[model samples]
Target: MKIDLTQDMIDQGLTCPVGKRKIEYCDAKEVPGLYVLVTSSASANSSYYLRWKQHGKTKHTRIARVTDITLAEARSRALTLRREIATGNLTEEREQKRKQQMTYSDLFEEYVTYKRPFKRSIGKDIQFYNLRIKARFGSRLLSSISRHDLQKFQADLIKEELSEATADLYLRLLKHSMSLAEQWEYIEKSPGKGLKLFNPDNAVENHLSKEELKRLVDVLMSDENRPVCQIVLWLLSTGARLNEALKARWEHIDRNKRQWTIPATNAKSKRSRVVPLNDTAMGILEQLETEGQHETLWVNAKTGKRYTTIQKVWQRLRLKAGLPHFRLHDARHSFAAMVANDGTTSLYAIGTLLGHKSNVSTRRYAKYSSDTLQSISNHASDVIQDAMNGDT
Candidate 1:
């Protein structure tokens, strides 16, 4: 009925709340707790009772009165109680009595410890963000964090010259940690609420054309370093991440099944994936078997240690080939493009082969594949001629 309760009504029975809804306190005959009175509309003939909750020596609040109450005012009172319970404000006084138990560092440490056995990159990424997070919000209790704190963290990363995509990754890590806190009931909402990540479309271009791929392969093959050449071929044939390929062990291969069983411990997605090794991929593996360094498939030529960084190797290869700044990881992009271009596999299968968790990540390969397909037949003669002349 939109009736506004006056001060006299509050002193008597009816009181207006924050938004000017009038409520009348009442004794519950049908329900277990105290009740409040409400009317459905301005012209409604009857009012109804809503159950009230009385906090012992703290404050009085309403919970529910009569389930069948149809008055608008009664429903509004019930709705308000529902919100209070949803946000866990029904017993704030009691909740505040417990001591604050954890800080951001404490929670982050828990997250790291829980994720330690899953993947090495998880450990590396946790350490990477740990320094930044501690520098900004170390002293603050986890309960005290808010969206503003996350905003400042993102701003600080931007100020440090981190590209938007990299900064967004750091922020997302924090968001994921905070989500764990939410699941533990440490907080009602994530501090990273309302945060928006920078669009990856603006940052790095990951795809490479077939010509670029041919040029890179040609340069690598002509170099005296045969290990890098084989590495390039395996990367292109398997579409694996650089780190994944570098850390591959002989123990993971099943020659009979023609599959490499990448363990969750070594995979970025924390899920083991079996990549089918094509004949070309198997040939590269066989070539590496002759190198006989360590049990690993790839190793450093100079130190004879398992290769870790492809930075210098990639730089020399690209510079010698007259290619612009493109990463070795682009080989995976080339593989996905070729597979999709030839119509040998669907986009979803391409994504699965690449170890991507979603179809969205795989969709980017579709564009390059579509473009490659249009000229596949026309370019065959030139590709053959270039290979014959050793001018690829």
Candidate 2:
């Protein structure tokens, strides 16, 4: 039904036919397509809407609940939306002129700063942006970025010999930033949505062979970066993450209990967990304490600060060991693989020792046959046992 909508008219209340769902009362005097829907239920909320046709189909956009705003406000918003729909511009010229376009670099700076204080992987975000993303999209205007631009960037990553996983990481950061930009009103919508992620699920854990383990150990023994090497050793022997090992302090460990308590603040899961220290790990700790490598567990003997990253030292060591493809994180995987493949430890037990919150983390190694697992377990079985039992 057509009527001039007013605060007094709506205040009088409305009703619909007994069998009908709701009724529409459109404003004929002011905004042509503006309407108010009054449902059959007396207590139900009545909503204002603006109706239009697109591609030979009727469309309706809700303005607001009648009770939430005055009649004047509803008409004003409806008229504005009508103009936006007709012109394909959501904002008025005054608004467009008031805000300058933000470049990708501007977004990157603001994004990193916003997330830096709490995000654990903020370092990688900065690294990827500076190393790859900034070169391509740094100066590009946020308004000008499209799905094609992102697609081309993804292709270039593959051409440059970057793996799909690495490309995915870069794009994931960019996409999330774009999403935030959209939320912040830099754009109408995110271009990153529906950009197909290139990497597929490959959950296979990287396990070091007997010879590779020996080579890594040999390299660790001779390397000048003794602190980082010990960190790597700690990761391998205890199945702890790099950050966990780096942030560990003397107070967190109990020699008599042979267990280290990871504080909730430092842990990835943000929960305090106690991991038993193996004989090998305990030996490394005892040596560190004797030498007084600060109060922190792993530190640069030369600089007297805790090792923030083992990447630089790891690169040199991996190359010297002729295992350039190996990553420091792979040491933890190798540790899990060793104990899991040995057949003595259950999957749940391995998850607990690795401080994994669930079995899914250890489930990948569960697929290997006994023969395949036994070969991988040869070197680290004793060390893993030491971790489980805290004794030889």
Candidate 3:
């Protein structure tokens, strides 16, 4: 049936016929595929639609509501859709294009599957996403995320009492994820491009002095905290990282050769290295070897398993030694300082001993090497003065 849609008829509230299978609509007189769709009494408002047959299939496309667009505007839009349908563009193709856009959660899943296998700190990344990132932006579309969104996220992290370094880490991870999204074509470009990071003053070196080191060692030897004392002693002697020493296994050690091989899987650099053990390091390993029943080198006597942490016991030990301000990693710094102060070992040799992947890390100890140089300069001055006084 055909009818000219009037504003008075629309205002009176048009309804569909009783027992009709679908909404009863009247075809417009002026436009071929345009119709005034009268919904059932259950619906509050009526809308317009364009219907046509192409390639043995019927397609219906919604235009706009009668309350939103005028009759003249609906007719014009219907005409354009009819022309596109006649030119072989199907409505299903447009719907498929709309579904192709990826959301932030979608891209994050893909990134985890593709990138996490090779990342050393994948656990930390997953934790950050679950704890904060996913809750804030998971449902948002990838293209919808902007630099302002990332800036706000950084601010939120700071407001939550996270340290500046930690907040910077989270922001960096988000930026990295977005970059991966772009590489995989999920996004056109990273929204977090050129975003500023919090300035973390991580360059400050906190090392122990000789007197402080001696006191700490004495306290560790005297205290009942055997596991922490052993771990701290191992760190001081071998310069091994905390995680590396904690995960040490019996199979990797060679007592006869006085070497400990850090596997690529457990190493931060993801490359294996053979760490030569000094007499002191060898003694600690011998003690552990006699005491440990499991395959792992370091095991908690109480749990009969690998020691996961020594944070609390280490704090008490530091306090007992009167070095309450020192951190666990200061032992590593002390090792580098001790080696650099000897005046004989080159910076490259010190770096090799510390398992440093790059010279940039070892160069931080150059300041300690000045002590050795100053001593040599003083000795030379004394020798020159004695020769001049001899007058021979």
Candidate 1 local lDDT, 1-392, one digit each (tens): 23442324333434334554445544333222234444333111112433334443533343322323323445566567656655767565544443155777787876776555433668666666666877776677888989988988888889999999888878888888888677445677888877898866863556567677778778876887778778878888999988898889888989899999888877888689999999989888777753445788887868877888777777887888777677787778778878887755778888889999889888887775665565666589788989999995
Rank candidates, TM-score, best first: 3, 1, 2
Which clashing pairs does model 3 show?
none
lDDT of 2 by residue, 131-198 (tens): 98898999988889998999999999999998889899989998999986774456778899999997
Error of 2 at 346 (Å): 5.0
In Å, residue 174's CA in model 3 sits off its true spot by 1.8
**Best model number under lDDT:** 2
Residue pairs in clash, model 2: none
- Top TM-score prediction, candidate number: 3
**lDDT value, residue 168 of candidate 1:** 82
In TM-score terms, candidate 3 sits at 0.63
Candidate 3 off by > 4 Å: 1-100, 130-132, 152-162, 203-205, 224-227, 289-293, 372-392
Ten contiguous residues minimizing lDDT sum, candidate 3 = 37-46
- Candidate 3 lDDT, tens digit per residue, 212-284? 8889889978888777798999998888888899999888989899999999887877788888999998888
lDDT of 2 at 109: 84
